[model samples]
Target: MLEILFEDDYYVAVNKPNGLLVHRTRIAEEKKEFALQILRDQLGYHLFTVHRLDRGTSGVLLFAKSSKVATLTVKAFEERQMEKLYYAIVRGYTPPEGTIDNPVKPDKDHKHKAPQDAITHYKQLGTVELAIPVGRYQTARYSLVQVVPETGRMHQIRKHFAHLRHYIVGDKRHGDWRHNKMFFDELQSPFLLLHAAMLGFEHPVTKQYMEVHAPVPQNMARLCTQFGWKDVLPAAVFPPASEAL
Candidate 1:
């Protein structure tokens, strides 16, 4: 069952697990389970998706309980009224903080078409070095980063990180195969390390600001523990509740 993070009369959010599709899609036809169907069945009511997370990503996923709420919530997302936070274990050490401003095409087929603007801001929370060597490096290095994408595009965070050459660990499509394999073999974790840790937006009906947080997945948390980062990582990713939205 999906973990319910927050729910109310008009909306519901879940701590989506990695490897679960948000809904049925032509890309992965063989998959039998989906978050949409599971949540609907579990709640005994139809829910409309306000946004989406990649199948490999786990974190706060919101759903509207009714069509009206869905429309309003979607508008909020499109207008950039919502703030989303993601945590990632990335290759190498990222800058203490930076922004990626690059335009992206929807797909390879649209390579010649005009690209849409994509921007992402990130902060390095912690770093770790492992004895395991990768590529030409004598030891492996990784950083935990808090990422906020200002403009949403298909795989924006993954693509931007790859562009910067700091690929997210376990990102198969746009990541370093060697690094991915290292995590799989050494850490016994093949799942993507990117997670949607928090979501903040205004209530459509009440117009009250609210924020919802989802705990890091066990696998990622374990990796943090192994890296001696269990304490600092969460403090950076999940800030104190007193921090205003």
Candidate 2:
């Protein structure tokens, strides 16, 4: 079942799971399930998607209850009135804080695609070093970072991080295959580490400020615990004791 993080008369948000598509696409034509369809079925009503999350990324995804509401919310995003927060585990120990103002191609399908302006600000929340060795490195190192993208370009965070040479741990397309192999074989984590942790926007109906939060996946949470970085995660990421394992 999709975890509903926030809902109102005008909109609803869900904690979309990794590997789930926001909707059917030619790239993933063989896929059978989608977040939009599942949520529509779960609520027994129609939904209007305001944005999208990559199939390999998970976290707060919003939908409008109706067409009118969808229009309003979409405008907010275009105007940069919405705030998006993400959590990512990337290769190597990142600096305390940094910004990536690199440009990225809108899509990889086009050979001479025009690059769009993309900026990502990140703060390092934690770091860990493992004795495990891979490739030329004697040991492995990684950092937990909170990311806030100033622009909503497709694959912005992934591409920006790659430009910085700090690839996200499980990003198959733009990551270090060596580190990905190490994470899968040694850490038992084969899922993308990028997660949409939270979203902030004005209520389309109420015109009031609001924020929605999504808990990190259990695998991601487990890694934080092992790295002693659980304290850095927001309290909203944890469910009640009854819901926890």
Candidate 3:
């Protein structure tokens, strides 16, 4: 069953797991399972998607119960009325706090199209160094960061971090191969480290503000605990001590 985070008469939200598709797409035609189908069947009602999360991302995904509500929710997103918070572990230490203001293509195929404005604000939460050699460095360094994307663009966080040279761990498409291989071979963590931890928006029908939080997945939680970063994450999203690993 999907892990539900929030629900109401007009909308529903779930903690979408990594590797689950939101819906059918030409890129993943062979995939049989999707979050939309599973949640619709589980709730026994038709649902409408308001936004999308990448297949490798796990976190709060919201859906509207009706077409009208879906339209309103989508409008909220386009107007930048919704707030999203993401957590990630990257290959090197990031600035204590900084905003990455860069433009990115809409998608991989849009090379000829003008890039769209994309801004990402990030705050470093914790840092760790391991006595392990990979490439030229005799030690491996990483940081845990809380990220807020002011402008939602395709792969903006991943691409911006890549441009800054602090690639997100396990990001196969935009990361350092040696560091990714190190985590895979030594830490046994091959999943993308990016997670959508929270979503905040006003209810379209009720006009009341709502915030939904998705606990960090076990794989990511275990790594955070190992690095002593548990205290920096929101308490609501951290798993219990007994269940974290």
Best by lDDT: 3
| Residue-level error in angstroms, candidate 3, position 10 | 0.7
Candidate number of the best TM-score: 3
Given candidate 2, what's the lDDT at residue 140? 92
Among all windows of ten consecutive residues in candidate 3, which has the lowest summed lDDT? 235-244
Q: Candidate 2: worst 10 consecutive residues by lDDT? A: 236-245
* Model 2 per-residue lDDT tens digits across residues 1-245: 89999888888899998889999998888989999999999999999999999999999999999999999988988888999999999999899999999888866576477888888999999999999998988999999999999999888899999988999999999899999999899989999999999999879788888999999988888888888888778788744431333
- Model 2, CA-based lDDT: 0.90
Candidate that beats the other on TM-score, 2 or 3, i.e. the better one = 3
lDDT of 1 at 155: 89
* Runs of candidate 2 exceeding 4 Å displacement: 239-245
Which residue pairs clash within candidate 1? none
lDDT of each: 0.90, 0.90, 0.91
Report the lDDT of model 2 for residue 26: 84
Taking the tens digit of each residue's C-alpha lDDT, what string does model 3 give over 1-245? 89999887988999999889999999899999999999999999999999999888899999999999999989989999999999999988888999999887666667778988999999999999999899999999999999999988888899999989999998888889999999999999888899999999988889999899999888999999889988888787896762448
True-structure Cα RMSD, model 1: 3.9
Query: Which stretches of model 1 miss by more than 4 angstroms?
Result: 109-113, 235-245
